[model samples]
Target: MERTTLFHIFAAVLFLYNLPACLSRTSPNITTDQSALLALKSSVTLPPDHILVNNWTTTTPSSVCDWVGVTCGKLHGRVAALDLSNMGIIGTIPPHLGNLSFLVLLNITNNGFHGDLPEELVNIRRLQYMDVQFNKFSGQIPQWFGGFPNLVYLNVGNNSFSDSIPQDFGNLQKLKVLNMKFNQFTGFIPRIIFNMSLLELLNLKGNSLSGNLPANMCNHLPNLKFLDLSLNELEGQFPPGLQECSNLQVLSLLHNQFMGHIPSEIGNLTMLEKLYLGFNSLEGEIPNEFTNLVNLEILDLQSANLTGCIPSFLFNMSSLQWIELPYNNFFGSLPMNICPRPLLRVLVMAGNKVSGNIPTEIGNCTALTVIDLHENNFTGTIPEEFATIGYIAPEYGHEGLVSTNCDIYSFGIMMMEIFTRKKPTDEMFTSDLSLKRWVSEALVNGVTQAIDSRLIRQEEEHYFAEASCVSSIFELALNCTEESPENRINIKDALALLQKIRLEFQAKLSEN
Candidate 1:
């Protein structure tokens, strides 16, 4: 009888002792969450001695919530967020991550992660924000991504994802910011995406997306503020219905094949701040209606085959800052009363048919930093104020002649300034110690001594190769700035030399 009583006591003690662990393993929150996180840790290719190597161990006394890059919901005690941005972790995402049912945010930007995202991610229905930008992720974006009704921000930019964007993305009715730039997405933008009334920022730049934008694109996008479609193969007329986006602030459509006139209807966007329509096949004058954009800041229309005199109102707009209209057929002299706005900075009208004296009123623009008026019919000498800026070639001062060689000389000075990070008029330079003379003297010591220190790292493996490349550049600059125009290297030779230097430097880097 005593033996039976002892056996019963031992059984009760053992059951009591194992009760907590048994309950933990069986619970829906504890064991499942920890296992899911451990699966993620096992999947990624972390660096040796990474903090996650030590902090993400199950042997630690801390709970799963205490692991690196993991956050748990207080009430449910489930993983709610995982952010490992810029952690240098590599490898494909594991399918097991879909088990974190409570996860709302997943950010793995600026990593080396690659491969198609596991389709099981669709199970994370509660996901609201997902950023996998600046990674090597490839393959078609899974169509199931659009099924997340709660997703508000989605960015998969700077990846190699190809194929047409799925039309199902329009189902994300609550999505506010959608960035798919720098991918290989092709074909027409899905018409349904334009119907997303809540979308505020849409960036599809640097893709192979083709076809015309729908005419009714802005009709339902009432809240749209930023739209960028640059660097694509898209071709068609500029959408006339763009006026419907009353709240639109930035419109960038550069580097496309859009043909036809600048639609006057764009004048309706009074809130517009930036307008980029460069490198297209568009024609016609700046629409008079553009004068209505009192809030305009940047206006880029370079290489668009535009004709007619620049509208006078553009120079007078107080809000105007950047005015780039180069490589066009714009005629007529710059207005004497140009640059009324103190904010005017970049004024490029190069390769045009403009004539008459360079206007002195440009001096009114206190912020003006770039002024390109070359390859024009301007006949008079440069304004005295511009002559004093120290970038004018020496021949321009002595002979007062403007020729293509003078441009070559100026370009050499600019190149030296760029590599040395020193202005021609820097305080350290004087009449006998010009930037050109200083760099010329440094060649005897070592051209690397004259290079911008920020660009050089002696400890790097390719440091000497890079320094040799800089020396070649300086030699080319000196050739361009030879005293006699006849002795200067032509722009063609300079370009070829630069190409050779670049190839050689790349080869040396590969060797290292």
Candidate 2:
């Protein structure tokens, strides 16, 4: 009983030293909050705007509350929030901060504060949001973090904390967002966290957290809207309960070791707008059920082992803006009715075995901006309609056009490259038989041999129309490649001839 009395007496003395009003009529809460601000101020160095160095020193009733990045209660006059993010300050956190029992939000992100989080932080019982990310804080993630009674948002990503995620984090009953990415954390993800039913966004990407995810990952966190597990060592088949997540919007699992067929159940995630599953070992054909994802805008499946003919339904989805399925083994011809409405923007499907000629119906994709079709077995001439649409350009690497009429030579070369599907620098052409000489010789015989193989298969009218267009363009290209620059055809004449060829070609297409 004597010990209790003495302890109370000592505590009162200490409070008086810090708060300056422990035994006086003034409010101890505001004084204590001021002292806490001073404590944090002591650790900060190189305050750029003199925000902390000048303003936070004076603790008078109106002084500290009006300082930068500090918010005080309107009625109680106690510090309730501190936002010091990206202030270019350096120093470790001070332990004296537990005095700010009223602090509800503390953000020191993008600063240089390092070392283990002070144990006193657990005393901030009312802290609802805390972000210490983009700092150099190292050491185990504080285990006492479970003590924050009201924390709802916690972001300590981009740090060096090397601890298994505290299983006790499940104690944060109000937590809706937890981001701890880019840490050195290892060991199985604590199963306790999945019990947080209120979590809506969980980002643990860029960590070394090994071991497969818990099988019931989505069952408990039914409110999750954005989940990013990319750039980790997570293995095993994709999480099992993913299909049950009906509200997920952005699910990125790229650059991991996850294998197995992409689940057909993914079709059930109709709300997903962006799905990234690249740089993994996933195999098997894309499920036809993907057609149901009418709302999906971006889908990335690069660097996987996925196979089967490219599905035609992908072109029918009006909302798909970017589709990246490169470095896979997908085969079969491109769909004839590609992008039925002209909403598709980027379609990257290079580094595959896809064959057959590109369809002329591709001209319907008016919104298509980029199409990467490199390193494939596509055997065909360039589509003349695509060239007419200004999508293809002539190869001028070998042909020198140094005169005022250079544009004329360029246009003519482009015209020839289009019909023959052979660029000027093609390997088959030696100096003795350049692309110019080769095309000129073919024109002397007939336009048939120089024509693109794809065009050769067209019906009678197209074949004859293509032959006439090829003959005229080939003759113009030869005139442009004359030994003397001045002898080359002028730009005006070349354009006029090209325009006539296009009109005749369009007429033939119309007849067909």
TM-score versus the correct structure, for each prediction = 0.75, 0.70
lDDT digits (tens) for residues 1-512 of candidate 1: 12322343344344333433222323467777788778878988887789899898778777777678866665556777788888998888888888888777788999989998988888999887788999999989889888899887788999999999999998999988888999999888999999999988899999999999888899999988889999999898877699999988899999999999998988998989999999999999999989989899999999999999967889888798999999999999888988666677678999999999988776565455567888899997777556444566666655666778877887788889899999777778887898888889888887877899999889977899989998889989988888888898989989999999999999999888
- Model 1: residue 92 alpha-carbon error in angstroms: 0.6
lDDT of 2 at 124: 87
lDDT of each: 0.83, 0.77
lDDT of 2 by residue, 1-512 (tens): 12322343344334323442222224556768777778777877774566566666664445566678866665455776778988888888888888787777788899999888999989889887788999999988988999887887788999999968888787997887888989998888888888888887788999888888887888888877778888888899878889877788889999988999988899999888889999999989999989888789999999978999999888888788899999999999888887687777678999999899877776666555456677778776645444322222232212311344544555666667787887654567665876677888887886687788876656664777778777877888878756556787787777787798889889888888
Model 2 poorest ten-residue lDDT run: 389-398
